[model samples]
Target: MSNESVRVVLVNTTHPGNIGAVARAMKNMGQSELVLVAPRSFPDEQAVWRSVGAADILENATVVETLAEAVADCHFIVGTSARGRRIPWPTLDPRACARQVLERRNSGQQVALVFGREDRGLTNEELQICNLHLHIPSHEDYTSLNLAMAVQVVCYELRMLALEGSLSSDAQSEWDAPFATAENVERYLEHLEQTLIEIGFLDPVAPRQLMTRLRRLYGRMNLDEMELNILRGILTETQKSLHKSSTAK
Candidate 1:
């Protein structure tokens, strides 16, 4: 696993000590990159004091104003949450989430794992930006974990995945390279929605929630460039067929 492919991001962290501890945890796992989004007390003397031998991580950390800025380059994002949200989204355990991250990294994609504030966790808006939600299994009665502890657990799982080499026999082959870029996927999605609209699959007046669900489904697949092209071609052909059918009628 390329060390630079995966990054750990802490958003709105309030405690300087926690930040230092997180850096230490990441270093212990042989991971170096750390990003801070709108930290409350960054570069603080307390933080530097606590970082100890991992001070290099603190010095090299990218401090950004917004969460989006911190993760804009990342192709895959996984957010950690201890509680279920009001919205419906598929949730994965830490190990499963780590596997997903590894797969994306091995495919030469940058991935970001986001951890929210220490006090309240991620807000609804922040959670929406993430493609996957990860939760560490714990005792049912008291599951709220310290921010540093949460980071440690997640970093540990990711490190283990990296060390283990291949988690399954179905490891990605060279042929499974990304066929399309992020921009290509977005354009294809737009074209798909337009085609669906033209075919009356989506109501013009009041479109159903199909597109959002489809987006989520496709996001989970992390479609490569070739797979995306195939899907786009199918959509284009379907549109042509619809046009012919309309002309015939």
Candidate 2:
């Protein structure tokens, strides 16, 4: 799969100039897809000025209303977090995150590396939506980093992974199926939860962390399209069975 399948998504970005720099960083690293989610300001002169030679990335960027819309089609999503949240998440450093992303991309999966707003980073809700978390190891004394700089660091790691040719000729000999996108997995999860609720397998209100835990499990599995669809079909059939039993009763 081409690196073009990897998208760089910015969520709730506040600075127009930062968006430009992010585009530049992505372009330099051979990633071209740019998705902007609710930027405070865009299509502004400063963004164009800062994009410099990466005007194409800026020009072709897709602006969306929410993070969900931005990554709806992605198979894997790596969200960047500057700090830990109350709800723990599976975390990886920049290099490791890049490896996982490239691995998915090599198998023909659409992936997204998401960056949050400059001031607050990603909210808990936003982080929960991602498959995995990536944190840049910075000095404890001073961890504050500009949004663009963080984008550059992550992009640089991806660039290095591309240069190293991590998926060598030997790896290419194996059949790599087209995997399900993150969106597909997410949709299946929703379908599953709904089916369970319909059958009284899951409580409707205050579901606790059951779905969250299940998401973590599936994310680690890196499920392909066939696997995901099979699971969803099982849920559908189970729901149909429940309907038939109720009608007979």
Candidate 3:
């Protein structure tokens, strides 16, 4: 199954117990990969105690210094938050989120379902790294969720989608190009930002939200090799035009 390809990423997780509980939830859902980004406390006694039989996940968990490092190789990234952002992200409720993950996983692409910190959730900059945002609908008056509880709910939806035999796909895409990895797309965004600045379309000194919003938009496009090449060619031509203008002056 593609379960092994689904990575659960915890960013800036503070509570050791919550991390352990997340491990248990992931194990229950058959997801083996767990990435912890700058967690406050891990390998704690409380976490081990809470994990019980799922301590293997905690022991095998890959800890990184940054969220980018955590999901660098993933082809699809989904982040979770309790509230909305000022510039809304492409979102899916738990059900649609599961389907998207499963589809990408089935297509042999690694996917990361990211959970944010306990108190404030993912920062706007971190959320920009994601392709999709997900929120679990809860009571309107009191919507706060414990970190582990949110993990459990998302994991449960994933497990249910698998059990229900809904993960299959009949549509065959003729394109052979693989979906661009998150790292590659990130680099592409950097190139795009630089080109835009060179073309005088984007003021480098006051970029504002231009790059972030663009990243959010193209992050979901799942650009293939041909598409990426075409985009880079356009950027190359734009740069050539800038060089020509400078030579003329």
lDDT of 3 by residue, 62-150 (tens): 98999999988999999997665899788888988998888887888989989998888999899999999999998999888888888
- Of models 2 and 3, which has the larger lDDT? 2
TM-score of 3: 0.64
The runs of at least 3 residues in candidate 1 whose Cα sits more than 4 Å from the true structure, single-residue gaps closed, are 1-5, 166-249
RMSD of each: 20.4, 22.9, 22.7
TM-score of 1: 0.64
Candidate 1 residue lDDT tens string, 7-112 = 8999999999889988888888778889999999989877877777999999999999998998998898889887668887668988898888888887888999
Candidate 2 lDDT by residue in tens digits, 129-218: 999999999999998888888888888888888877666555534646677899998899899889878978789787888888988998
TM-score of 2: 0.65
Model 3 worst lDDT window (10 residues): 166-175
| Alpha-carbon shift of residue 110 in model 3 (angstroms) | 0.5
Quote the positional error of residue 1 for candidate 1 in Å.
7.4
Task: Tell me the spans in candidate 3 whose CA falls farther than 4 Å from its real position.
Answer: 1-5, 166-249
For each candidate, the alpha-carbon lDDT, in order, equals: 0.85, 0.86, 0.85
